[model samples]
Target: MSTLDALQAALAEEHATLWTYGVLGARTSQSASPALYDAVTAAYRRHRARRDQLRLLVRDAGGEPVAAAVAYELDGALVRPPQVQRAAVGLEAAGVETLLALVARSSGEVRDWALTEATWSAVWQLELGGAAQTWPGAPELD
Candidate 1:
């Protein structure tokens, strides 16, 4: 895929992650857990920032950035702590995949950015559970 294509895909993933984090924050806020609520809020902010950056990158590359979907279908209700954590894990997993694609097809600053994002996603995954891979954004071998 081209750099534009990778940027577009990363933008889409960021949009989805933004929406997913909204759900996570809402559900965790209900429990009155300050820590989880703060984490979700931070993640939401990060995704939003990344989304905007991606749009700029796409435009600089002479391509129109894709818009976010009207709504995203989540795995399930995030009423409980475990449910919210699982949602976060799922979002990070998706991010890792998107960033991996970007890393593979991008160069210079874009490649560095993708690698950083993937590393952050991996850290988030580890925080959510014991989910850590040798290569965070790499596809698993059969």
Candidate 2:
């Protein structure tokens, strides 16, 4: 795929991730889990920043960015701590996939940026109770 396509995919993932984190934050807040709440809040901010970056990248490449969906279909209700953690893991894993695709199709500064985002997603996946994979982003290789 082209760089613009990869960037659009990443932006779509960011949009979904932002929505997932919103649900996570709400559930964590309701559970009174201060630590989880903080983590979710931080993740939400990171995804938002990444989303904005992806939009800029698309625009710089002379392409219009894709708009976010009105709503995303989550796996299930994230009403408890364990569920919230699981949702986080899934979100981060999905992010890793998206960023890895972006990295493969991008170059120079864009590739570097995608790599950084993928690394962050991998770290977040581990933090959210995912096992450390031999290849964090390229799970198909593993």
Candidate 3:
């Protein structure tokens, strides 16, 4: 995939992550985890910001941003407490993998550079993601 292609893929991943978070947040009891709720909200905002950046880049290249899916596959059949945490981990892992792939598949100097930067950002994001999802309710709102 080219840089533009990688960007689009990253955009899609963002969309997917956004969707998954929405579902997970909704499934979780807001009252039960105020902190988690706040964190999730913040994560969404950040995702939206990054998404806009990606969209602008795509648009500047005369391409439209990929539309988000109306629904996600629920990331497999994980639904219980531990299952939910495991699911979150799985989603974040997938996002990291895609981002890394984008970096590897990228072409062009500027685009490659952007991909590299995005890859590093994702590495950091995944670390946080790992902690948040490591335990069923570790960073849960308390």
Candidate 4:
């Protein structure tokens, strides 16, 4: 796919991630699990920033930014902290994969930006209780 297409896909993932984080944050209690709540809040802000960045990137690349869906379908139940952590890991993993695709399909500043984003997402996976993988984005290698 083209670089613009890859970027749009990554932006779409960020949009969904932001929404899912909101759900996770609502379920997580600051008093009961302060660390988790803080992590969720930080992640939400980070993804929102990424979404905004992607929109600008798309515009700079001469493409119209893709609009986010009204809501995204989540995988499984996210009632407990463990479940929420797992869901967060999954979201980061997905982001890493999407960013990797963007990295491969782009060059120069866009590729560099995607690599940085992918690195962050990979680290987040481990922080969220995911086992470290040799290739964080490439599940086929793990």
Clashes per candidate, residues 3 or more apart or on different chains:
0, 0, 3, 0
lDDT, residue 135, candidate 3: 25
> Which candidate gets the maximum TM-score versus the true structure?
4
User: Model 1, residue 12: what's the lDDT?
Assistant: 89
Write candidate 1's Cα lDDT for 13-114 as tens digits. Answer: 899899889878877863577767777777788788888989998998899999999999988777888789878888888898898899899899989988
- State the lDDT at 31 in candidate 3: 84
lDDT of 3 at 124: 40
Q: Which run of 10 residues does model 2 get worst, by summed lDDT? A: 29-38
Q: Write the per-residue lDDT of candidate 3 for residues 56-135, one digit (tens) a residue.
A: 87776677899998887775654444455555555555655665666566556545655554554444444444543342
Q: What is the Å distance of residue 109 in model 1 from its true position?
A: 0.8
Cα deviation of 134, candidate 4, in Å: 0.7
Show where candidate 1 strays beyond 4 Å.
Answer: none
Model 1 global lDDT (CA atoms, 0 to 1): 0.84
Q: Relative to the true structure, how large is the alpha-carbon lDDT of every model?
A: 0.84, 0.88, 0.63, 0.91
Rank by lDDT (best first)? 4, 2, 1, 3
- The residue pairs found clashing in candidate 2 are none
* Selected candidate, larger lDDT, 1 vs 3: 1
Measured with C-alpha atoms, the lDDT of residue 126 in candidate 2 is: 76
- The list of candidate 3 runs beyond 4 A from truth reads 77-81, 105-142
lDDT by residue for model 4 over 33-114, one digit each (tens)?
8888888888898899899999999999899999989999988899999999889989999999999999999999999989
- Model 4 worst lDDT run, 10 consecutive residues: 121-130
- The regions of model 2 sitting more than 4 angstroms off are none
Global fold similarity of model 2 (TM-score): 0.94
